[model samples]
Target chain A: MTELSELHEAPAPSHAGLDVGNVDELHEAITAQDKTRIRELLDLDLEHPAELADRLEQLSHSDRKTLAELCPDVFSPALLAELEDDVVEDVLPLLSSRQISRAMEELESDDAVQLFEELSDEAREEVLEELPEQERREIEESLSFDEETAGRLMQREFVAAPEFWTVGQTIDHMREQGERGGDNLPEKFFDVYVIDAHFHPIGYVPLSTLMRSQRGTLLRDLMDTNLTVITPDMDQEDVAYLFEKYDLISAPVVDADGRLTGMITVDDMVEVIQEENTEDMLALAGVSEAGLVDTVADTVKARAPWLFVNLLTAMLASSVISLFQNEISQLVALAVLMPIVASMGGNTGTQALTVAI
Target chain B: MTELSELHEAPAPSHAGLDVGNVDELHEAITAQDKTRIRELLDLDLEHPAELADRLEQLSHSDRKTLAELCPDVFSPALLAELEDDVVEDVLPLLSSRQISRAMEELESDDAVQLFEELSDEAREEVLEELPEQERREIEESLSFDEETAGRLMQREFVAAPEFWTVGQTIDHMREQGERGGDNLPEKFFDVYVIDAHFHPIGYVPLSTLMRSQRGTLLRDLMDTNLTVITPDMDQEDVAYLFEKYDLISAPVVDADGRLTGMITVDDMVEVIQEENTEDMLALAGVSEAGLVDTVADTVKARAPWLFVNLLTAMLASSVISLFQNEISQLVALAVLMPIVASMGGNTGTQALTVAI
Candidate 1:
């Protein structure tokens, strides 16, 4: 097993050796060692049991139902993040209440909220009851914020320092806190807010500056006052633009009183940028929302109504065509050339709309 | 002047200090002391200069002839990047030969190619002659590539290392190269291509892994074998899809013989992503492109053509409407609510088209 592992991690080819059958051959080679080849093959495609759960979801109901009977732990939260809502709804009902509770506890707030949003009311109540009191309260509190706002998107874990502290004190605090189980401070952070006695955000000290500054420097003097403070209720689009325009790594989210509540990091903003881009693209396309892990029926439902509207618009345009029908019948050249003109017009219009929207 | 300079640098209330009173005032604001401020404001709201340029170009011949005396460098390459092709044409003649040479030199190869492609035969010849021999050759060569190909969009600056080198040696090489003239390398980079003796890309080591790994790790050992190399002539859309599918940050571009030519960084890919999203959005809207910077006339032109094509298509649908006109005339409710069904259909079609496209 060790030798095979080493072989799998071998040095790269001098040039891209990607071939069409790469995934197939690689899988076959891995499975040649054992009769557990089928399970290994599935594991190869999915690095963990959890991812298998997600992909299995895309399969038909019977397939997932059968697969679940064999491997229940595949209903992991990581897998839930990857599943479409409809498929998730189908799969969640089949899972034991214990399994569902475990998955919710394991997932991030956003992913957990999304999965919870898809559940039937009765199922939600049952699952909520299963969670530890603290976890359930946090999830419920997070849910109270408007969907897609900073309050909802921000992770709860963050580090802050009082304005009067020195850089040395702040570092010592972080060190002590980490040792005492503060190790979960967001995997990445850019700035630490300096709050006043009342927790009002007075300034921000960037991590880079903190790293470079002398240890004894007072935190207040080291902080940047030209901060872009965001309201919890601000639209995600505005947040994304502020981040882009200011080249911000992180910004503090505050309430109406300007007190620091949560910090919005660049990583979260990256998702917002992508989402906003998707929204603009979808909206301009005339759908309020397009596929965000949408199923076939959901996709159909989302799109069909728009096409029907187009059919009506087409009908209206055809009435204009009928207005010129006598003129068209008198001169078929107008009909043929008319299409050319209209085609040109349509192309031009599309170009214009692309620029405008 | 120093006090004013300080005041200008200070961050003011949002939209408070904006003075859009006159063209000269807008010009002064655009060319402010802070380059960042200028860039930010240009991105914000203002009359689209391209629109003004188009209108000015259509003025009496005497007015058009005298417009060359206006501030020349105002038609900077950055501004040119923002302008539409038709608008670019109007402004080109107004620019002095020196300014033209400067703008040409400042522009990326792709942008230069695009601008030069729109110039009149005599103007192109004159401008081409004014450019340095090397730059003129580079632009002309790049212009020769088919539009919307990888060759058209790639930047010439990229970093690659020999496959035999350790990660330490590669980092040292990058530092040394940066110390020399490689400071002109793109502002951001992601992957370091490991090239063979003949300069063909063998594999890639992601920057993230490189940053985390021990310095002495061999490049070949660290490389990811699942390299996605793009050919110069590949369609940009396909390239974008590949990037999205593999979550690529950067990829090496290869020529017909599989020899590495240059690298395409993710920042460039980011622009492509935005452009493609915009294209899809507009295309789904039944328009070819969004005319964001278009004039009322340009907007009308862009939309009229599509509306015209729509007219023909509508007539086709109207013939259907006519077949049922009597049914509609008898049932007034059909006339009233028929539009509702069609409107819904149009919306649905757009939604589906948005997703499908």
Candidate 2:
């Protein structure tokens, strides 16, 4: 399949991936109300089944209503794992509380934590009450991590073998583990952390190196010593930079006690990069935040403060114009040209800021 | 091989494909030269091979110095493509005339035209004289297109097939033609333009579509009728929007006669998106232009005029302060809070302007 087609058909779990086909199809489906075709497409067994499930979930509520209620079972946990927080929130309410609890149970600690974060306080409490005791503890424990830190971002599902294992054994273990029934595992991962007997991550083996190397290579011998251990408390931006600078696909996030907690993957980092880029662009523009996906009232509420501040600045500029009113009256050219100069200056300054920032 | 590794070693032709590895390696290499890496990375790659070729050919005797002789081939075509017009003028003379001619031949016509536009009268004549007649004619013809139009930005090298061709035949044709080798073939293309007997582009098939489709499918059957055609006179900004709005990988660029002349691809659009974004950012910041690779001098040059304009604006704001100077003399608190209000408003205004822009 073409990358574009794959991109469209198989939505990446992360909000970062652009499904051009889904976007187009969704647009068409919404306008035309092609519910039958949508249902057919939804039922089709797909290679990236999780992605397809998410796409179906993301379809308009009106569209989703047309599907049989039993269809929710077809929604994969990975699809739930891939959705945006706001999107998941919207979808969660549509599902039976049992389904919501099950999805939460199926999620890795970080994903469950995020899903919990997006819930209404009452719904969250209800969901927390419904979750199995072990699941609830994991969610609550992850919640203790600072927001927008590695702790919050990393997925708790990870493969780490003891340092004594041979590369062959590690691979075999992972393969054997796969044969056992597990409902949800990351469809892709890039590294295996080598841990001490006590579960302290000592080093890492990039999957690429592991795949190419001899099976008999000891995990300890093969692991990269110059490894980056992300502390749970470290900021997500710093995490992004480390990933970017080191070309890390996935890195282990450790607690203060040096215990491996979870892993942060490149796909997540890609979203962070795009989010950060949007933030920089918006911030440089003077927007308060990026992705103001809340209701229009919230968006306007967030946006208006900046506008009000701008009004004052504009008034300041206006006062400058008012000061030169006499000068402008005497030489209207100054008034006409003054704006040109200011406009050009604003443009130029923005350009400089664009590069510098 | 992983996409990241391929990206690392691919010799990225444009900044559009610049992966983290290149930036990191370049950062390290610059630091290894016993220079502050950040400062060095911030500067233009002026002595880049393609630029050096352009420079040695264009510079007058005595202006060429030891620095000019120490140029490196590692300097990229992309770097030269991004040089400021003024900087291009200053450096092109250091290049060998033959090298200049060869580099021009190697560059996309749009880039060659852009470089040609920056040359001095004497240098332009000398360089043009050295170029192959057909190549020179093509560049000159491209120059005839309005600046910042699709005609100027479009790559002439593209794959087009008659609508009657089956998928197998089209693939065979491309493979055979690639073996034969000629200028008409795009170095890389995202689509195959399907043309009618009259050579008017009827539809397009993304290379991915072409690769995935059944061999017996006719080109006409596979082609997407939802085509976004670019007229030579169309503005580049409008062109950028079409690519973005349609999620187009590539589209046919037509001449005044409505006949296909070239194709514009997403990679090119990606550069345009970045450039336009940079332009918007710089404009908002009151800077003239924020070319990422600008030298300190070039930066200062882009910035100074805006800074001067800002000085005048500041003075205008200062005059407001002066109006309140007497008030300030009476109450120092007025001065302090006055800055607060102005500062707050400035920040607010920037926020609004950023969103608007």
Best by TM-score: 1
**Model 1: per-residue Cα lDDT over B129-166, one tens digit each:** 89999888877767777888788777655667888898
lDDT of 2 by residue, B1-357 (tens): 121221112121243223455455443544345334533543443222333333332323333332345433322455456554655666677666666667677777767777778777788888889999988888888888888878888878778889999977876676556456535566555577888766777777765355344567799887776566777777786776555434355678776556778877655554555466657766776677644445689778877886676667766766555554444444443332443355555566777676665
**Per-model TM-score on C-alpha atoms:** 0.61, 0.53
Candidate 2 lDDT over residue span A1-357, tens digit each: 121222222112234234557656754654566666555555544424444644654466655554425366645565666666666777776666677788777766666777778777778878888888977887887888888877888887887889889967876676555446433344345567888766777777765355445567798887775566777777787776655444455788766666777888655665565456567778766566634336667667777776676667666766655554444444433433443355455556555456677
lDDT of each: 0.61, 0.62
Worst 10 residues of 1 chain B by lDDT: B1-10
Top DockQ hit: 1
| lDDT score, candidate 1, position B35 | 46
For each candidate, give the interface RMSD after superposing the true interface residues on Cα: 10.0, 12.9
**Please, what are the lDDT tens digits per residue for candidate 1 over residues A1-357?**
221222222123221223324335433533343325435546633253333443454355665665566656656677776665677888888888778888877765556777887788998899899999977987787778898777777655556789889877876676555456444454345577887777777678865355445567899888876667777677776676566545466677766665666777654565566677777677666565644456678767776675666676667766666665555444443333333444445455545555655
> Which stretches in model 2 have alpha-carbon errors above 4 Å?
A1-276, A290-297, A300-355, B1-89, B290-301, B317-337
* Model 1 spans with C-alpha error above 4 angstroms: A1-37, A40-58, A68-145, A150-232, A239-357, B1-24, B27-90, B96-137, B181-184, B288-293, B309-356
Give fnat, all candidates.
0.11, 0.10
Least well predicted 10-residue stretch by lDDT in candidate 2 chain A: A3-12
